[model samples]
Target chain A: MSHGYQAVGWSPFKKRYDLVLGGLLAGYLALFSLATLLLRPEITAETLLIRAFGTAALLLLHAVLAIGPLARLDGRFLPLLYNRRHLGVTMFLAALVHGALATFQFHALGDAPPLVSLLASNTRLDSLSQFPFQQLGLAALLILFLMAATSHDFWLAQLTAPVWKALHMGVYLAYALIVAHVALGALQDERSPLLAGALGAGVVAIAGLHLAAGRREAALDRERRAAGADGFVEVCGVDEIAEGRARVVTLGGERVAVFRYEGRLSALSNVCRHQNGPLGEGRIVDGCVTCPWHGYQYLPASGASPPPFSERVPTFRVRVVDRRVFVDPRPLPAGTPVAPAVVSESGGGG
Target chain B: MTPLDVATWIVRLAGAYAAAGLLFALLFLFVLRGVDRIDPSARAGSRGFRWIVLPGVAALWPLLLRRWLAGASEPPEESNAHRRAAAGGRG
Candidate 1:
């Protein structure tokens, strides 16, 4: 919500989320240390720290990447999506530690500056097997650092939702660079079949989850409904939308959420003003459509955030004809308050 | 030129850019916090928020610098399918 800017809007839930995240990170490090010591007792402390943090960061990155699609596929994962930025920033911090330690170990003592040495150390662009994968890791780290820096709502507001989203979409690039880094750099050096298998599994899991979620969205978008003479596309029946719930339909090449509240119907753009979350998936809360991602609320009729906040989504004129809800595919300007269509006992024109 | 020379030049250029960006980021953060305002969100914050946004500001200083110089105030409205249709007929 654009109510006001705070350093951090921490609550009990957020604190608990961070605590769990911290505990998981600590547990992973401890387990990794124990396993490394048991298997390779001659491994140096620096190498152990580097490997532990690097692998932990990669694992956390996978979780952060999967959470978006997982939430779309199942409502049970919505809670994870809320404070996912915390996980992202934490992941970046771990990656930073790994990068810093690696840089110090390999490049810091060179005559050239650390970054210059990192970039020029092995410029074997001609040979695929001898590619400078460290450069790829450095590039990914920069992207992650930028994302972590701008993870706050202030950046969202300053850069606008679309720009902020596009900037953060660099994560996919980061992930690809990281995959190449691991495949070419670490796996090549170690030649560990187990490590190679784990990497393959991580890639498969990420790709599989994303594909499933994308297919679901594509199917929803492919759901075509014909418009009536009045230019209203029939979405669903009144009974189809439960009380305080919405029926999402693709209309006018965009998804619209038709909500039935207090025996009336109102349709608005499915995209939330914050982060473009799926408003259709979120339920009505306290007389406002609360965005599941961040709980940003908007009046269903007006498609505007309740006072003291300024977020708005495009509204559509909705009417109920013979108990069937119809929405004007042409969206009204954002924050345009439209009269709610009524559903009567006899199912008259509403 | 060899790949090593290319890498060296690229690294040197990037290092220079980063140094200039850090200076600009300092000016943007501490000195020009009150002026060169992009939004009220930028204005309405303490030191904590500034530090959080420091790296981003440093990376994106040129764009922010342009915006600040142009006297841009409010964040622009982002247009998408919904907004494009809402502005006029569905196109």
Candidate 2:
């Protein structure tokens, strides 16, 4: 019942932003359409469709960028991360509509085979000011298409995580393209107050969240450094540590754990590889330290773990001098296999 | 609507429905699962921000449609029991 690491498949069943947005948009459009139909009675169908599709496309773009920071700031916001793909695809669909409608109204009827017109209209590739803005939209659309195409797990599996991840980083590029696309296309022409404010808000929100996340992470790192030991520290007599148990020790800026396991004494980096939980607070099982936060296990000897769950922590050199344990602050390369410092039953020399 | 207008409207309507439906269904299924896999707490539409909905619908619908057309499911997580057994039954 197994195929060689065939990437696990997902079929999620959960709430989504689609309902909330869909309802909002649908409600907005329905009201607009009905009002236009009743009150004005002379609005062109094409114009009506154009505005609706354009608004939808822009809204979708805004959603795609906000999900990350929102999740970082709040635990309850995690659901947004799961369905971000859906959010992205939804935005693409809206953009597709905008593209198709724009294509039909402006390019299709009077043009020579829409493709030629699209290529020709933005005729000035060289001039910055005179450059055809539609081309930017075209570029953005292409990037979105590429992202959408590779969104599936099938493609993701074929591409592996790193390649898939790298490819998807293209979103940043696509976002830039869209920004230029909008600046050139919409801002240049209509300069609509509502549209400009909405766009600006989206960009600001994304930038703010990223900045906040960075600052928070940096603060945590600073705190960890302050708690860690800068140089050697002397601890209890060699026999004081029980086998297979870890003791937390604070040395200057570093918080290091001295672990005794399998008749071997070793030192491990206090920070857990997962979520930076204090590893020294964890319990030892089978010569490995199991993190208290998420139970990520690391071998005390080398800080390495079995395959598919491979992770490592920095190991320190330990020595017993004059019957007391001394730890050198200089850390060994994380995960490098090293022998534990052992004490003899004879105790210290007379 | 003129015949040409009708044709355009039909395409537009279809595209919109397709986009929205695909987004909702896809979000309901695949991306939701991805959220669960990466971090089970991630749910869609939790923020209630009007802007977040745009990407939700845009990216999700097409993904669902593509999955249906391509016959692919969302990616799944490694079951703890299965992984433990594979890791030789150690806790």
Candidate 3:
């Protein structure tokens, strides 16, 4: 939301969020380490720390993955979604600590390099029970490293938002690798039903939440409005949309948000330019349509961000006739300014 | 080849790719060209920003290199369902 990029874009809210997260992370690691020590005094410090960080990372990864579906299902969790990159980067750091320590402990003394030893030492492909799982963990770490490196808006702007998003979608692949790494490595070694149960529960919970959100989205897409002659679709009653708000309707395989403000109706593509956020879900602020995800603003008339910002979304011609809002299914070029259809002008077939 | 041998080759190849990426990033960030031409916002990005972006540059060096070599001065236009629909208006 700025013309220029800063190192970290540090803000008051980000500072507070990071502080709270730091406190929680430290507390969790301390508690895990204490519990492990009390339960097994025979364990060495390195082993204890590795397990503590590894479990912490796994738990954090689940939280990171769950936050998306949770936010989609409920707006209350949107704050978590806002700074999820921080959560993901924190998870990667925790995982890096676990990986570095484990490598040092397990392979440092070998004649080959630590990475070489890690890859060459474990060759138990003969049995599923003894398969090499460190490779899986390492692979996941590499993906996370790449993701964390490119998490900033600099990359988003450089690579284009869609490409950046596609790259970050590697998170799902990393998640799968991590699940396999744990199920085959730690669970095999520990042989603890409780551990197994926790893993299963996490996977199920994440999957279930995603499916629930997907169902809700599918329902929205199903309510596509029937278009009439002149390529205009009658979406909803003008009274249905509150002032400074929008009613999103699917038309011609695209979602358009018809917004009402100051007795005038305007239509814009539902997608925001920054992150493809739902502009329909956001309300007008300071006479501008503000995005719900990151507050990226666009003018309802031109579907363009105000001066100093060049981003734009497609604007559709819209009018209200007989108190029913009708929008043209074909969108105008982005940033094209069209006179808003006033309520009184509707009688003239505006 | 055995699974282990296959894995070792993959790891070695990836490692070499990363090493090359890191070296290329160092030159690209410092000597090759200014980011202002590629991206205006990165005109005077901070040291911390450059350090943080090293891994990303290492990972996507090939793409960046191609863009840089081709003298691409702006980011590509994003295409999506809405944009595709809008493109129909042009046709």
Candidate 4:
């Protein structure tokens, strides 16, 4: 039997039906539970199922949001990135259930259908604690619905990458609204300190992860600027690099790696395209620079060719003037990464 | 079957289905970890957290009351046999 091990990579395929059905089931279950709770029906086996599902779904949403920063912080968690859409859609469905049950029980009874009641109910908008958290849930659900609908590659292809990315950013807005919904609706009535603390912790953890990532990115930017060849006044001797050793230099606003081999020096873009790994920290292995993180190798001479993969980094022209290496700030074409470009004692004398 | 028998069967069926759903959900909790492993992109960690923490506490709760009132004992008999065998071996 052929072990049909599907090559595990980012699945380009969208799970439209799973999201759709899951959303419907969650919405119905929530409405049913809310209706019974408001009516004060005897606590039956059905009530137990509803409570468990609601609790589980709420926890899952928090887990899903945490996965994004967790993955970015560590590459091992990249697996979560590939299936992020599934988690998001599933959580949306769960929240929908809670919303639906709520609408049916609280809003529907003596008026138009539950959906109409939700739309028409504007009486509680003025009050702080009395604000219809259901409306907030509705708004959040609408945003999630839009996101879940467009999560497929088909929709992604229809919407340009920029538009798709912009649309997906609505998740932050949805999350904010959901927080308000819970604070006003659930916590207001329940007054459970444990639940309130859990919510607070979730918000803090998610925000902290993003803030930490932003700080790291800012630091990387600083390092990139300092390492640029032009950032350093022509160092006393550009020829300071020992054979096979790479020197980090700054030129203009870009970081470049200057390496000496066979009495010649070459400059290459110091940033590894994969996660912006530090090319300076990497060592030359068989004439190829290997990234320390995932072992993505690039030819130091041309900055290309780790075959079956076709990505190129920019290279710069370097000239030695009285042992001082001067580099032209203009970047070479990405594919024209010339490995081991001839370095000379006189600027551009090669 | 009588109407009462049919009614009883329906109730039993519902209970069985609910139990099945619970069992499936528990198995899903474990299987999710498997799915997470098979498709590493699915979940974060191993699926045994339920067995390690939830099952022990939840399953033991009702058992505690059952044994408290009835003095239910079985493992003691098995252990007593082992103790007797050890003592006999020494004697």
TM-score of 3: 0.94
Q: For each candidate, what TM-score against the reference?
A: 0.95, 0.51, 0.94, 0.50
Whole-model lDDT for model 1 versus the true structure?
0.87
Identify the superior model by TM-score, candidate 1 or candidate 4.
1
Q: Compute the lDDT of residue A96 as modeled in candidate 4.
A: 69
Tens-place lDDT per residue, model 1, A173-283, is: 999999999998888878569999999999999999999999998999998888888898888888889888899998877889998888788999998878888898888
Winner of 1 and 3 under lDDT: 1
Better of 1 and 3 by TM-score: 1
- Report the lDDT tens digits of candidate 2 across residue range A217-272: 45644642121254566765766776666766644345567887655678877765
The CA lDDT of each predicted structure is 0.87, 0.60, 0.85, 0.57
The residue ranges of model 1 lying beyond 4 angstroms of the native Cα positions read: A345-349, B1-4, B34-36, B89-91
Question: Which runs in model 4 stand beyond 4 Å of their true positions?
Answer: A1-54, A107-110, A155-160, A224-350, B1-91
Which candidate leads in lDDT? 1
Q: What does candidate 3's lDDT look like per residue over B30-50, in tens digits?
A: 666445567766666676777
Interface RMSD, all candidates in order, equals 2.1, 15.2, 2.5, 30.2
lDDT of 2 at A14: 29
TM-score of chain B in each prediction: 0.85, 0.34, 0.80, 0.35
Off by over 4 Å in 2: A1-12, A15-25, A28-42, A124-131, A221-350, B1-91
lDDT of 4 at A103: 64
Poorest 10 consecutive residues of model 3 chain B by lDDT?
B33-42
